[model samples]
Target: MVPQNPGAAAAGRAAPVHYTHRQILEILSGLMIAMLTTMISTSVVGTALPTIVGDLGGQDQLSWVASASLLTMTASTPLWGKLSDILGRKLMFQSALVIFVLASVGAGLSQNIGQLIAARAFQGLGVGGVSALAQVILGDVVPPRERGRYSGYMGAVFGVATVAGPMLGGFIVDADGLGWRWCFYVCVPLAIISLVVMQKVLKLPKIKRDTRIDIFGAFTITGAATVVMLILTMGGKEFDWSSMWTYLLAAVAVVLVIGAVFAERAAREPILPPRLFRNPTFVLCSIASLAVGVAMFGAMIYLPQYLQIVKGMSPTRSGLMTLPMVAAMFVTSTGSGQVVTRLGRYKWFPVVGLALVASSMYLLSRLHVDSSKLVIGADIAVLGAGLGLTLQIMILAAQNAAAITDLAATTSGVSFFRNLGGAIGTAAFGAILNNRLTHHLTEGLAAAHVRPPAGGGTSLGTPDAVQHLPQPFKGIVLEAFTQSLQTVFLVGVPVALVGFVVVLFLKELPLRSSVSRVDQAPSTSPAPTDAPASTPATAPTPNTTA
Candidate 1:
């Protein structure tokens, strides 16, 4: 049916527009660099952190350096996305870059652990913006049907950074003159290059409209998340799990979350819009992302401990050992993305992916203290393949399902859940490991009638520290850790299956062919993109499977 007023309809939006493959690649280069800065920050620090804390002289504060960033990064993600809607995406992206660059400098020059931790926290605020905006920007620049092809490159970047960060961190700490400071300093130049390229190549139409900052909503949500994160990080380590402190913090987090809900309802432009929750696709994707985080990060963090402490490998070697997983992730993510783009069907990838995740977690649980490296490698590769298929595809589906007006919120909301899940999984898994290890150690020590070693051998500080324990004690400690890790992997199986169940319910809407959602109201929000900007023409249309 022809439009009653063709000229008026055409005037409502810019002419039908899309980017050439070359144009998309140009924009993606800048995004990929910024993405690397965020991705590698934590993992790179993981290896160098041992050396960093040793030189800085605050062994107790070591965990804070990592957790602080994660805490801030996860909490601040939604705020960044909302700000992009109020302000413009380009300015927000550039602003995050500046913040990150400055924080990196401070982190490198720090003479004390406190300063380093503080800088890392600030780095997280920036990292949060860069991380969320990258996905939001991707949605703005590419349509859902063709998005998979470019997302493949993003998966490759993620795969590379995941392994490279640890390897580079180990190399830096090992090199005579490089030092731990270089670990922070090294990304500075790459970030600066990214900033320059973004300035030159990335362009999105400027939007001018009256928009509120949603200050109250931001505060409540951040407070709620921060309180929960503090409980997770501090519990089972800084204090007793059953202590009054835990109870107090948990109560505070609950109250803050309740407050956040009300604040979001009242605010004109909430950080997380209430309506997004009503979208089935958004809810399902968020749930699935949370599970993905639990499986992916739980494995990433603990597997290293298993390799370094249980199997006696160097940090560099452990990083290298995980390459099989990375290779599998790269192949499946890219391959699956290409298939999704061609067929315009994505439900199968994540469904199959989560099944693999569940299967791999169970396989990992079956690992013995004496499991061969090849067997371990094979199990992780399955995990990599599953993660590759699920991670970004969930975001893509969420984006495709949202209205043009909700694009940024949908992208960031899913991301926030994924990171939140990671925080929860990492902390919960840590607790499980500590508890199970304690039980196993007690049993082993009693069986042999051995006394506890000089420095509380059960906790056994680092992987390096575990290696130095005397003969029988070393063997006992290794066995305890091995058993505890099996429980950790085993626990993840149920979690992955839950995510698989959630993804199965998601509605696969037809992939939109245009850069912007043409069937919605004129998008008032400013988005980062190179595509032509115009008001949408047609009345909002319901999603139909493509």
Candidate 2:
């Protein structure tokens, strides 16, 4: 008999249900569009940042352009997931798509860098919502034992976006009159199309709960995250790292985090339930996700920039350069998902994957301005292979470890950390690049004995515009930019390895064949076997794996 889980009963009365392959695919078709829409919205701008900043004249705030969206996405992820548990999944999913479409409009219409960042921040709210719910809805239908089959499809969608976004952005930016704003505009049509498709295709067993939304928990957490992001993205650039304002902001962040912890403890339907942290799988997966986020976004956002700025490649060429990495990601992510489904084991994927990620980052650090296209492609391919292995597996492990009632919470918790890592990583790496670039540029220019440009320092411009700089100055600029990028890539090595170490402690629990936690099989294979039997999602021993 399956052991009774009190937590499952307390959350909501879930009806046991399942869908056929056709039905599942139909639902996924719409979900994939939404996923593609958001994923494209992010990467499409990776190659466009220089042009965006050049047009708006806020090179210092360039990182904020990306960080603003990521910040809101990270902060709002859990709230979206938790709310879906209380509200209807279909209702929540559609709402997010609409929000994303409208925000895309605002982003495209923006005249200033500040306006664009604001619009992106709003867009991130929808991004956070749609991404979390997509996974939640998947859990509602696909049993943990079989989730890998569908997860491969999600990985494929992600791969496509990674490939298409940059290439499209490059083509648009390079094409006359289309401009970088079109990058934001391109996602709107896709999002609108997905909204209608999801409305008709997606269906789920609704769990209606009368519990109050954790407004306090959400507020404190959002506030804390915002402050931390401000410090990370702004500290050295906005003010000196050791300035009094930095200390004040740090203290405020600490207080807000403490408030969030207390609020969550008291909340009836906490945005992030304190109980989920008790599960070792959840905790370990969260760590791995956070580290991976740092490494993944750090690479994705910069590789294209490096090619365009330092190597003097057109935006289109830069986008094309990333194909190897994206291709590897597609193959490995799909392959790993299938392997996990067939073998019923996932722990090794992450342990090995994260190691690959760290090694890849090291390989990237080794790149110079003169590195061959073959070497560059091979290094990033390693990164793609690493990410493909771990990205979906971490979430799968977390979901399988959770009670069915906690599915939404578990999925959101992992996503929240990953986005948080991305936001901070993007900003931190940007700052690292900018800081090193400033120093190297100054020194290189001085060594060259070139007079300072009109703006006093190196006047930032689009990749094409930068090509117009005269002789030794142009040569110095490439060397300095390449050197700065080296630091950014090297810093990522330790960060990804931190994830590798944390994942080692993540014990692989048996996958569940049933969709409901309360209906799991009683028997569990306690030893290694060709196919270990499924296990019940028991209440885990707090802070202990056993």
Candidate 3:
């Protein structure tokens, strides 16, 4: 017989176990701590990277530092969700915290870029869990109607982390003798505190489950995602776009995905169940997520470059300049969440958000070398407003569409795709920026009657030396910056348009308060062999797997 409380067998005794309001609050606080701490780690590093790369003597590896984290996080996202479903929420949450803390320490102490990237990959595994599982657990503790307020807090935490990360990273990096490694050092203590608080305060019902996990599906999907990411990373950079290497990688990714599809179909408990894709809301939301991820990530990643490269701002100053956008996002997201919670409606946000995003991107495309700082800042603010409206609400939409039991997995699936899109966007757009910049620089050199450098195509955007170019050359470099940034905006326009289209098809569903999952479960009364009885609402249908 399945034990009613799984923790009972471990404790070997009955324990008092009704959760009160105060107890639930205490439990949620642990999750909030973990959420803020993890987001801080992500944003802080992005701001400090310029300093870190200069010290490490490998500017080439800068993208990899970020890419490594995204890759592992994307690949492991569904695994975390599936495992949490099988292993009990509290166990997975605490385990994720411990892994994150240890990984934070390793990241801080790394001596080389390779070590740093490897540590980040490991750290990402925990980050992947924390982000996915937190939302999952939140769905458990709160009903859909009440979840908006909490989701708002999550958006605020995200905004705060993004805004604060750059400032904090800049401070730690610029502080005399503290060095860039301390940026990583800063989060370690916070993580420890989060861990202790979680252990002390968090108490979730343990699911007494005994089921086989879809190990093969996890492996296949991970393989598929990794291969696809590699293709995006290496295309038009390390290999020719039409080269054999490109075709080979593409083929491998395609084959693995086909295998994964079949594997998911057969698995007793799939990591990413193919059936979820058939839900119209889930499908549209996922598509919209891809577009939103591309637009948001590509723009954010490049704006700092525009500040540092063309505007001639220091890393710290650039980070500060980003405050307006991040700040605007924070306010709007929190306010919108509360409004949605109170009004009981949300269909308009995505439509309006994508419109704002598209308009803002179009405005940003108009930026040139001579554009004023005021204009650029204004554009970023508009983009931030769009993002504030889009990101978390799509998650709410996905949650509302899913069955109660699939809440965590469905939410994480949306998150996983969004992040996966971001990784691909960042890598792909970075390559585009590099290629376009090089081409413009070459054309400028040719027009100026200047000889190409002896070794040919030496790096032109070196941070220490870019500002020192002669007057006409500096103008040319800035023009290249303008051109490359314009291309990013051009690419983003179509992405937002696509998002607009997908969101138009989404069906509106009512947001409900928490369901009584335990109360609704089937009764264990023995079947009466001799009398006809009415079927219960909880009785399993013929096709029901559960």
Best-fitting candidate, scored by TM-score:
2
Per-residue CA lDDT of candidate 2, range 1-546, in tens?
A: 112344443433343455778888998898899999999999899888888888888777888998998999999999889878667788888888889888999999999988999999999999999898899888877888889878878988888899899899999998998988999999988988998888777766554454568898999999998998898888878799999989999999999999999998877668888888889999999999999999999898888878988888887888888898889989988998898889888899889899999999999999998999999999989998899889999999999998776789999999999999999899999889888989999999888888766764765677777788877777888898889999999999999999999999999888888776655433241321211246322322211000
lDDT of each: 0.81, 0.85, 0.76
Write model 3 residue lDDT over 154-255, tens digit each, in one string.
888778777787778767777898867887778878878878887777655554433468888988988998888787776777898899999999999989
- Distance from true position, residue 281, model 2, in Å? 0.3
| Candidate No. with top lDDT | 2
Residue 267 in model 3: lDDT:
74
The residue pairs in collision within model 3 are none
Where does model 3 exceed 4 Å of error?
1-25, 58-60, 452-456, 460-462, 516-546
Which is the better candidate, 1 or 3, if ranked by TM-score? 1
lDDT of 1 at 135: 85
State the lDDT of candidate 1 residue by residue for 166-215, as single tens digits: 88877887788987898888878878998998888776654443457878
* Winner on lDDT (1 vs 3): 1
